[model samples]
Target: MFDSRHIRTFHAVVASGSYSAAARLLGYTQPAITQQMKALERAAGTPLFTRLGRRMQLTEAGESLARHAETILGTLSAAESQLKAYARLRTGRVRLCGFPSANATLVPEALSALAAEHPGVQVELLEGEPPASLRRLERGECDITLAFTYPGLHEEVPDEVVEVRLLEDQLTVLLPTGHALARRRAVHLADLAEERWIAGCPRCRANLLHECAGLGFVPDIRFATDDNLVVQSLVAQGLGVAMMPALVLPSLSLTRVCGRTLEPAARRHISAYVRRDHLRIPATAVVLDMLRQVAANRVGC
Candidate 1:
């Protein structure tokens, strides 16, 4: 059986025109190249090369072998490329869950990139809050879900779930344009006690209250909504202030509400949560890598 190594050595020596040059290209010693050639000639039952004044000249047998080597190598390379393409186009369905805030940018961009690369792969997206998304994943209703941990109120994800941290979305204060705290460089939890707060949802509000209590005061909750857009719109109307993660910044669509980094620097760590047992799937692995890369690029990491 003619091995790939033997064929490769033959191709390299013919292309480089000398054993020393071919050895340099292949990272093999000159003696090793000579040995490979001798082995190949022995297998072929003929002299492949003639020694002429320290240089190598191809015999008729060598010329014939070289032509066959070229075709064989080309065929092998094509086969490898086709295998890679098949893997890239692996047909499967991946169910993904995420919040609307993330859907604004990172989630959608990563999905678009994945779709472009793997057209045969089918992806189903479900939009919901983090806790709901996590539940869906835990129940095996979805393959992966986007999750986040707010300051002082970390949700305990199950040990059976593997979480891949995508990015640290720094928490920012969303205040109206004319608000007193908005004029300053940044606001701390202690600085905004007098103002009313716009909460995201009941769970999000509960999390906010817990985070605020850690800072020593409960914010007066004037309104609450799961919609970040609505929360920003309320803030713009001078209804109340809110905090949002950096993932929500790019597609906020509200010019009146300004996003400023909070003092004492809080951040929500966004991650991809998947069942540990199902990670062997290549479709999920490649998509997860793409999400991490996109998130890192956005945060200057």
Candidate 2:
């Protein structure tokens, strides 16, 4: 019988395309990966890989074995998830990641609810922008991620990821207390065509440009930063105006800055994403449930 560890290493090597890459993914040295592959070939009674220069190519037997290995590993993973569920979620860890605004807003309430309900479950949190958070989720570094996409600007979620929409986050124009547009019930993008702008991250700035182009004007962005608080501070000091999502607006002081809805209503769709298999994990499911509830309550929906 072959050891599962050897088979797992073989699978990693095939997936990663090189021993060094597999070692990095599996937290093993290159020599260790080489040894495991050798052992696996011996157990199978056939050579599994052929070397073409520096590249490793799987043999016919290796291809057959790889298919079986995937089935075996997938079954094992499902079995482990089932066992954890049978244990009533008394112990297990769920790693969650999210963008900055979601981390500050809905995530806190969801985490609080999770802790109160599942006292025995451990939680880990990571903060990043939407793209980075999604990358972590794909790499298995996070079980779930809170991510957002501007409806007209960002592409749809990838087919491999399972996403659950939480809420629609509306964008608001933030102006200095003494600015001419500060008291408007809603501000049109064209109204601020001549004002200097404070922009957010690259994705946000791109979206701003797209929206402004629709209004027949391009903003003169004088400042750029990913930090929402810094953007607010700049606006507060009368440096420039900015557009921010509703979720991040709560973090800004209203004394020096005021937010008004956009006339055409720019918005983003906020969602939680996970690998399809991760949805079977009880802890992940619980956290997703709590997040949905928090979003519903916040939006009064």
Candidate 3:
């Protein structure tokens, strides 16, 4: 195979019109230029240059290689420019997968900030719970994922992926306006042990059970749903009480419903997860930074 460096040197010598001139242009000694030309000719299996008086002229083989060199070098130069643009965040794409609440809250804000700072970097968003989002990431369907987990309640994160804690989202107790516990400054899990319960996504349901079990009673969960509005509506009708993350509370209208922090402070940790190798991707890294910036500052980069 022809070495690109040797081809480059061939062009320099042809363009500069002499071995000594090519050496000076290329920052190499005259002897180095001669050696490179010799190697290039051997690879081509024919002589490339001949002297015509004081001038160097291209032989037939030299003319053929030179004709293709322009296309070759142009392609190489264009590729390098694109790589530079990607590294500088001037152009790139990031696929972001997030759950429902985060899509409503952190994901939008972070994405807005990212677009403002990097207009050329495009982003695609997918909404799903942690398990689905993480699975997509593992399958190379996404570049970054926004997910949350209850401490010690969920399975361990995959070894190939790394988690960045964006914020600690406190779980708030949702109750109907007329519910007896709605007036309390804070509600204890034990206080509502016997009330009918509403559960959310799988992880949240697991957390509720884990905490309730610790309090020595099982909840009579009457409803299950992944939608926040559904959970809120159920609580508003006084059908059940539910626990939700603090991040989602503000966007939801509390009409006929109210929220209180758990007495001992149960929290679902919000995080951005990416494969370890993705940390080197500028677009992904930038998105992670923006998420941490817009989050509650409960944690840092």
TM-score of 2: 0.70
lDDT of each: 0.83, 0.87, 0.87
TM-score of each: 0.67, 0.70, 0.87
How far residue 205's Cα lies from its native spot in candidate 1, in Å, is 1.8
List model 3 lDDT by residue over 180-207, tens digit each.
8888979998998889999999888988
lDDT of 1 at 278: 68
Better of 1 and 2 by lDDT: 2
Candidate of highest TM-score:
3
Positional deviation of residue 161's Cα in model 3 after best superposition, in angstroms: 2.3
What is the Cα-based lDDT of residue 223 in candidate 2? 99
- Model 1 score (lDDT): 0.83
Error of 3 at 186 (Å): 1.6
List the pairs of residues colliding in candidate 3.
none
RMSD of each: 10.5, 15.1, 2.7
Q: Looking at candidate 1, what is the lDDT of residue 224? A: 82
